[model samples]
Target: MSTAHTALIVPPRLGEPLRVVPVEGPDSLKDLLGGDFESVARGDWHLYLNAEGTTGDLPANLRAAQLMHDCGLDLAGAARGPAVILGRDAKGKDTNIPEHLLRRAEELFGTPQAA
Candidate 1:
C-alpha cells in the first residue's frame, strides 16, 4: 500500500485569508472534496505521503481521480477571481499544480480552517 500527503492552500478572496491544510487519505480528502468523487487517470492522480506520520495506505490513482471529480463539483459553484494554491508534496517539498480545482472550494465555501 502506498500513502501520500497533499496540502491545499486556499487563498483569501471570496471571504477568507490563506489556509494550509493537509489531506492524508480518501476519507480526509472527502472532507475537502465533498461529493462527486471519481477515479484519477494520469495527470489527475498523484500521491505525497508523510514519512513521519502514519495514515493507512495511500489511495489508488482511481481514488485520487474520484477526489478530483469531487473538487470539480465544488469549483462549479465557486466565485471567479483569485487563484487558489494546490501543493502536492511528494518529497515533503511543495510542488504547485497550475490548474487546480480545489481553489473553487475556497471561493465557494469560505475557509473554515483559515480562522
Candidate 2:
C-alpha cells in the first residue's frame, strides 16, 4: 500500500515533531509500538494507538489526541504513543483515515513537519 495509508502524528516521545508512517494493520502494529496494541473508537474512526503506552517508555500523545478532538472525533483522553487513525473500507477492512477527516486533522494540527 502507498504511504498515504499511514497515520499522521507526533513521535511516541514527547517534544518530537509530527510524522506520517505506514500502518498495515493491527498485526503490523506490534512492530511499530514494540508490543501489543489496542484500538480505541472515536466515532467512525478507530485509533490503533500503543496499548502499553500508559506504562511504556512513550509519553501521552496529547497533541495527536487534541488534533483528533478538534477534527470532531470524540477523543476521551490523552492518547498514548503514536496513534494510527483509520477507517473501515467497503469490505469492512481497516484502511487509511478518510480524506475529509484527514484534511480536518491537517487543518487543526497542521501537516507533518520536519523533525
Candidate 3:
C-alpha cells in the first residue's frame, strides 16, 4: 500500500515555540485517531474516557478545548457542558459578542483562534 502523510502544527508554550511534525503511514492514521477507535465506536460508554468520543474532527475539538482551558475556563466542564456560552438573542438566534470571542481568544493566547 502507498503511504500518505499529514502535517500537524503544535503550538508553542513559554519555552517552546511553534512545531510542525510530519506524520506518515499507519502511524499517521494512529495519530489521527488519537490511539482509539473501538472506544469511540461505543456511544457515551466512553464519555469520560479520553480519546473516546473523539474521531474525524477530534483534533480540532481537542485544540479548541485546550485553548479554552488556557483561557481561564474549565475545559472539562465545557466538554461536559458549554464551556464558552455562545450568545443568543430572545429569537434563539446567534448573536455576536461585542469584541468577538475570536479576538478575545487571540488576545489571550497570543495566537489566532482557529476559525
Q: Which stretches of candidate 2 lie over 4 Å from their true place?
A: 1-4, 13-15, 71-78, 90-92, 113-115
Tens digit of per-residue lDDT, candidate 1, span 51-102: 2111323222232223345655222322222222344444533343323544
Off by over 4 Å in 1: 1-4, 9-13, 38-115
Who is ahead in TM-score, 1 or 2? 2
The estimated TM-scores of all candidates read 0.31, 0.70, 0.29
Whole-model lDDT, candidate 1? 0.37
User: Could you say which candidate leads in TM-score?
Assistant: 2
| lDDT agreement with native, every candidate | 0.37, 0.65, 0.33
**By summed lDDT, which 10 consecutive residues of candidate 2 come out lowest?**
1-10
lDDT of 3 at 49: 20
The ten-residue window of minimal lDDT in model 1 covers: 50-59
Ranking by lDDT: 2, 1, 3
Model 2: clashing residue pairs? none
